[model samples]
Target: MSDRWQEMAVFVRVAESGSLSRAAREMELSQPSISRIINSLETRLGITLLLRTTRSVSLTDAGTVYLDRARNLLAEMEEAEQAARGVDSLHGVIRLAMPVVYGTRAVIPALATFMGRNPDLRVEIIITDARQNLIVDGVDVAIRLGVGQLDDSTFGARKLAVVERMVVAAPEYLLKHGTPTTPGELASHDCIIQQGAFGRESWRFVRNKTVTSVRVSARLWTNSGAGVTAAALAGLGIALATPLMAEDELRSGRLVRLLEPYQLPPAEVWAVFPAGPKPSAKVRAIVDHLAMSLGEKT
Candidate 1:
């Protein structure tokens, strides 16, 4: 069982680093030793984990599944060690990455209250639309929107909320250009799009029990959701945006929903962390608080 844990750790390192040599260097072990441990693990588990070639190695499907469980086990073991040391103090920095609009409008607003409650804990938030590599960036947590594609063995994700996208235009713009009664009419209008991680172009909708898709060409493109919303507010064009980002404008009547009849698929907001045995008290607390607070509003 002790050897099993060591082998599991080796496998996890390899999976994360994408190369046995890199994992060996990180673990301060020889490459041959790492390979031997992994082979021993495969023999014991009766499952082939890595498909290795001279050039590179990748996880087989079984490897991917086992990796997630192994991570959870390691995390739990770390937590147990911390608890035994009486290190219950939540005084570590938690680095988080999230989209700008969500960070500003949703997360930032909620953070003030969260921070006030946990004085020992500090948070560093990076706001960008780009999907950052959490391991490479040394990020503790990530707030992402959409169906999470992060492998279960490598990362753990909890759905925070379902974010519905809406077609919105400033009241003045809608009055001038006329509202798009249907999805097809959007082609005739000047569309402002957010062109980054959200993939706004490949828009999907459901009508009459049939799923339909449309590829939109935008005259103005910005990676910032705020920028796109601002363009829409200025009566420049129609914008597709999440309800949370457009909540203020939508409520103030600055931006009005167009094409109300068609329903678009909602993107899920998630709080994700690296999958390991047991998460620390601080990480668990933050995730729980964020899930509870942000879930209701979004």
Candidate 2:
């Protein structure tokens, strides 16, 4: 009601800079104006936000709590402003977090084309199997693969595509060890397993609407999806991999899909963002680009 957002922005900058003079310099506002804003904010909120001295300013306990919330509010405010303006010509660095496998195989290539189209936009991709918090990690958008519904509803999700897992091995490995026809028989075969989010090497398969999880001995177990793909390519053993991760290998007949009749638990690819007001235009643009490109492929 009282231009609270502006006050919050000024407050956050002051907290970060640790002095009114520094914050004023950074925000291009007079030091007196910055002091007046802080005074007005503290009076309105009925709380002492800063302990000011001749040379420094520090947040009180109340200020510490408010600062955290203020930062998020300011970010959402800027995003709302940008979205309202439109997404026709996007220009900014978007910090995107996604799984290592998909990020490398799909997102990286799509980004190449996206950057070519929008010469002004830059993307920073954080590739990891671990899930990252959008606000805490400062990630604008994140691509996640999950079975059916995502567990956390605090983040908004745009369904991109369905990810199908294939039990695959190199032709040389299959030729030497003989491909198993049933999911149960996987117990006897040497299976190269990539550790999934569940922190286990159990591979889940579905047939006739019934799901079964097979805990196979890993000829080699690794957290890296690329490592798993490489192992399978080198005739190490059977690995459960997403089609996109091994798209080229699958297409070129370097890796062969095994146990086709038995289905693996399918994952839905989602573009996720921190829950707030409508997403920023830059975020939407990248998410839309992924949906278009990945949708066609999947």
Candidate 3:
């Protein structure tokens, strides 16, 4: 009989990493050996699971369906082993994904506490503002922030908190240019716009059931949240930032919030996981911990 479990493990790792060489390195196996196992699996199954190119690898349609099922099977197997051992403590590595700024400022603190509680568990956090391919990346959980409900139904989502954006400027900038009281006045101000992932050249404000969108000009643009906050603090220009991003500066009176009468659309913070399988104990533990902790502040 074929070593079906071994082949499945190899295939899953290869799919998640998106590169055979990378998967081989992670699994501590030779590239040719990994390739052979995948080939044998495909030949035995009589279906091509992956579409390989010189530069990248992707799943075939059948491979996508198989992936979900495979995950379910693996999760069940792990649960069986854990149950047999009569131990429920969280262990092993949990891969997490989240945006850079919020993850650093918010999630990391909560994660530090969680790690302290679960001594056997290790976490690998991937910080990016861009939405990562969770299944392909092998992320155990993802924390996402967005203005509208996330359209993806493939992942099981838990809404953790809602965060509002803040329009802020350095105290010196507000003093030099004067603060904008109306949405229309923002056009005349030099606004710093974030440029990548969650980039927006325009901002929306609402008051008394009326919503207004103001397209502002930018002399400075950045992809990093820290960069936008830094530029604002240096008196470069006004910046649009999440409350968490501007919290310290706002508390110190280095930055001032403008147009307080209007409201910005609140972004929902979500903890998401792959849909096929029941969440592992580790996933549930961290999710609950974050929801309880971050919910209070946001």
Cα lDDT, model 3, residue 227: 87
Error of 3 at 77 (Å): 1.7
Candidate with more favorable, higher lDDT: 2 or 3: 3
Clashing pairs for model 1 are 68-153, 71-276, 71-277, 72-276, 72-277, 73-277, 75-277, 75-278, 76-277, 76-278
Superposed Cα RMSD, model 3: 2.6
RMSD of each: 6.6, 6.2, 2.6
Evaluated against the true structure, the overall lDDT of model 2 is 0.80
lDDT string for model 1 (1-298, tens) is 8998899889987886678887776677999999999999999989899999886678899998997888778777767766785754455567778888887888778777778876777787889987777654556678887633544445777777777788889989888988777787777888887765465666677878877777766788887778888899998888888887798888988889877778887778788777443555667777888888888875
lDDT of each: 0.78, 0.80, 0.83
In the range 1-298, model 3's lDDT, one tens digit per residue, is 3388878878877887788887787677999999999999999999999999887689999888887777667677767766776644566778899988899989999887888777788898999877788766778799988776676677788989888887899989988998899988999999997765346777889999999999888989887778889999999988888988898899999999988899988878999887433776678788999999899997
Q: Provide the lowest-lDDT 10-residue window in model 2.
A: 193-202
What's each prediction's TM-score?
A: 0.67, 0.70, 0.87
Clashes of each: 10, 0, 0
- Per-residue error (Å), model 2, residue 174: 3.5
The candidate, 1 or 2, that scores higher on lDDT is 2
The TM-score that candidate 1 achieves is 0.67
Error of 3 at 218 (Å): 3.2
TM-score of 3: 0.87
